[model samples]
Target: MSETSKMLWAVLGAFAIGFIVVGLSKQEESPEQKEAASMIRNYVTIQSMANQKCPEAILKQTGEEVYFPSETVSDKETYITLKWVGEKGFKKASCTVYGTLGGISELIIDDKVIIKKKI
Candidate 1:
């Protein structure tokens, strides 16, 4: 092959790899994301069930101070602990996750045990 053709093939190969990387990354949801989503869903459900007993659930991401857009987090790479601190201290609900969308093994709000499943 001519030198120019070889160069073109090399560039195309790089672009193809880049596209594959981006596409694969988008399809895969990080474990931390799955955990956080499950945790948040649990939080919302408990809050709604409280129905005036508990206030809005405020997310407390580990290692984050505060920011706009659901508040930024310094640690978003790993499945760190998350707490849904009940607003105004009316209620507090937290969970020990079972698996990816596997449901919470335990949920405690206001020092009361809501759910506890066997290991």
Candidate 2:
């Protein structure tokens, strides 16, 4: 046909190929990647809670300074701990994630328990 039609077809073909590749790559996500992603999401939720409810405990620093020392995943639950030191000695938040993101079962900040859900 015309040059313009040929160019359009070529672009469409490239777009289809790119979409297929992306879909395949996503399907190939390993168990480790999935677990990491879940942990990250759980961490973000915990941080957001800290920012909203206990802003004073959260110290101001580069994001790199935030540390997660513990991460344990069992068949029934996943536990993640986020710890950082602020002006007031040590600060920490521990999150227990359950049932494929059903909701955080518990979130403890420092010595205080912020969220404690039954089962």
Candidate 3:
């Protein structure tokens, strides 16, 4: 009816459209990021692994310097099964010699990371 009323309605419509567009775009923040931002915190520690090789691979890999996992937590069907390592109570561990490589991949001990290089 009036010019002022028409302009006000047009501006309101434009704002509604803009809000819709912005809401949709902001939804793409990624579930991983949102979950990480929750009140719960996550920790990631490195561990040793032959990835399935031998025990000495651990020593040789770490140059006899790093702490081996004393306990074991392995998955019967995978290459990574260690739970926690480098704590109190160190123990005598075993190794698997798979050809030229000799280390423990799923040792379930200290950190699952040891190598002629440390993975």
Candidate 4:
């Protein structure tokens, strides 16, 4: 084989190996990243639900402040708690979310249950 052909094959082989390594690494999602993603999804869900259920309770300009206090994971399920505290229009209201990793179980605003889904 020509020297140029050998060089090209070597570069292609290296590129293939690098691609495989990167693909394998990307397939394995870290637990922390998975948890963060789940929390983000929960936050979006809460925002949508609040907009639909209690539009008056949602802030207009900056929206509500979301904080994740705790996350618990078991073999069967994962639990994440999100808290939002700020002024809801003219009143000071707080929303606490009890979210499962795959779904939302409950959402409470100002100590009132806004949404409760069966697990």
Clashing pairs in model 1, backbone N/Cα/C closer than 3 A: none
Tens-digit lDDT string for candidate 4 (1-119) = 99999999999999999999998887778899999888777666655543343333333323664333223222222343444454543223333233343434555555666556665
Clashes of 4: 0
Identify the runs in model 2 with alpha carbons over 4 angstroms from their true place.
1-5, 55-119
What is candidate 2's lDDT per residue for 1-119, written digit by digit as tens?
99999999999999999999998877677899999888777666654543343333233222223333344433322433344443343455455544444555666656677667786
**Top TM-score prediction, candidate number:** 4
Worst 10 residues of 3 by lDDT: 39-48
lDDT of each: 0.48, 0.53, 0.41, 0.51
lDDT of 4 at 46: 56
| Candidate 1 vs candidate 4, lDDT winner | 4
What is candidate 3's CA lDDT for residue 115? Answer: 28
Instruction: Name the candidate, 3 or 4, with the larger lDDT value.
Output: 4
* Model 2 clashing residue pairs (backbone): none
lDDT of 2 at 66: 38
What tens-digit string does per-residue lDDT give for candidate 1 at 1-119? 99999999999999999999998888777899999897777655543343222122222322222111221121232222234544454244554443333444455566676566775
Per lDDT, the best of the predicted structures is 2
Tens-digit lDDT track of model 3 for 1-119: 99999999999999999999998887665788877654132111112334323434444543343334444443322223332232234333333222223233223234443322223
Candidate 2: count of backbone clashes, pairs at least 3 residues apart or interchain: 0
